[model samples]
Target: MTNPLFYAKILLFGEYGIIEDSQGLTLPYSFYKGALKFSSLDSEFEKKSNTHLTKYADYLLDLELPKGFELDVQKFQYEISEGLFFDSNIPQGYGVGSSGALVAAIFERYSITKYNPENISKDQLKNLKKVFGLMESYFHGRSSGIDPLICYMNLPILIENKESVDKVAIPESEEGKGAIFLIDSGMTGETGPMVQIFFEKMKTEGFRKTLKEEFIRYNNACIEAFLKKDMNPFFRNLKKLSNWAYEHFRPMIPESIFNVWKKGLDSNAYYLKLCGSGGGGYILGFTKDYEKAEKMLDGFHKEVIYRF
Candidate 1:
């Protein structure tokens, strides 16, 4: 039997800003996905995955299981023994929610109370986030559960603030000149250290003021404009947000791409932002013209995610 597939995700906006209650928008990126399967041949990768899964299962077993949450530990162990492994292509540390897919797969297969994304109540969603967050914290040191949430739901989620999140509709992809794309930074990003840097910066009053006054305002405007399909306002706010990130979140941006990022703003050909934690990983890009942006960004890899 073919197990379910969980797709990767991109947090289009709101990297560290979300921690300060800035609005965020996340969507599943089906181009990359993962699934759980039995490795009949038990190859090295499969064996490694099985071993990791066993350890994870053991960790879960030690937890004081919460009410209404049940994991069939024995069954999970049996599956691991049978060489069950996560077969995935999502790149770890690229900020595309690799572990998130694994967490979603585990929750779906093992959780007795299967919570369907469709029509799930806000309370149920909140509970699910807590569960996934705790489970994923093993990998990230800390987690907001947003990554796994997007993978689990496979839907676009609009984060109103730190407190409220709900599935939201986005403008339909259309054939047009403007596009959203991902650019490979040619390096992987670690979430924990990058997060630590953000927290350290938050210690300053200046950083706090910039986060609340400038970052959140533009972020909220970008989300609202994007959802409304108001491209002019979306790009306008996006440019400001991009500028803020460039000015303030320099540590998060890959050192190699600083010139490329600034070139976009200078030329107005494209704008770049963090796809995830942004120490390295993939850098997200937006452009009014893909062809022109490609010309401007020669010698780099680019993948078009959505066109408008």
Candidate 2:
């Protein structure tokens, strides 16, 4: 059977903050995606993927499956034996939900009581998040499940803190000067350690206060502003959030991009923030003028994600 494509995701806001109940916004990036397929035993890639799928299936079976979710383990094992594999182009460890996409694809095809994307309910969404979260914990030590949820739905997810998650609509693209882009840090980041650093930092009262008063406030406001198409306030709050991240989330930002990150803020031409857990991988960038931002970041690799 042919399976549907699962796309990558960008957590535009709320990298570590979402762990502390801060709001987050995630969008599907169709540029890179994955799907499930069965291939002949001749392909080495297919053999390796089949092996990994077997291990992953074993892990999922060990979990306390959520209600309304069922996996046909026998069939899955048979398929893997037949060289079932995930054929994907999404880069792993780049904070773009690569593993999440894989998990979503597996569940979409294997889960018997599947949640209908067209008519998903609050209960179904919550249950699906729980299932995906548990399934993904095998990769990241812990997950909010927002990544796979976005991949599964292929829709923008607005996280209004830990309790409330809803599929949100973003404003239509504008042929304007402002834009959102991704800057490659040229290194893969491990989410576990990056998250560990944030957790350790949270033990400090000052860090906790800064996160609550500054980070969460600006992060949430940025989402609201962008949704309303309030460009001025969006960039204004984004700048503040970017500055706060530079000052507080320094460890999470890779050493190589520190200068470039600061340069953007100093120039007032653009702003940069952690794309996911930071450390290394893709750093998110915002610019009021893409042409100018490109000139400023000429040497580095940058991909425009959304145009304002």
Candidate lDDT scores, in order, read: 0.89, 0.89
Give one digit per residue, the lDDT tens place, for model 1 in 1-308: 66999999999998888888888999999999999998783488888888899898888887655777677778888988887999999999899999999999988888888777898877777777778888888889888888999999999988777767788999999999999999998899999999999999999999999899999999899888889988898889889989999999999999878999999999889999999899988999999899999998898888899999
Worst 10 residues of 1 by lDDT: 63-72
Q: What is candidate 2's lDDT per residue for 1-308, written digit by digit as tens?
A: 86799999999998888998888999999999999998885788778888899998888777778667877777788888888899998888789998999989988888877667869976677778878888899999898888999999999988887867888999987788888999988898999999999999999999999999999999999999999988899989999999999999999898878998899989999999999998788999999899999998877888888998
The clash count of every prediction, one per candidate, is 0, 1
- Candidate 1 ranges with C-alpha deviation above 4 Å: none
lDDT of 2: 0.89
Looking at candidate 2, the ten consecutive residues that score lowest on lDDT are 66-75
Candidate 1: TM-score?
0.97
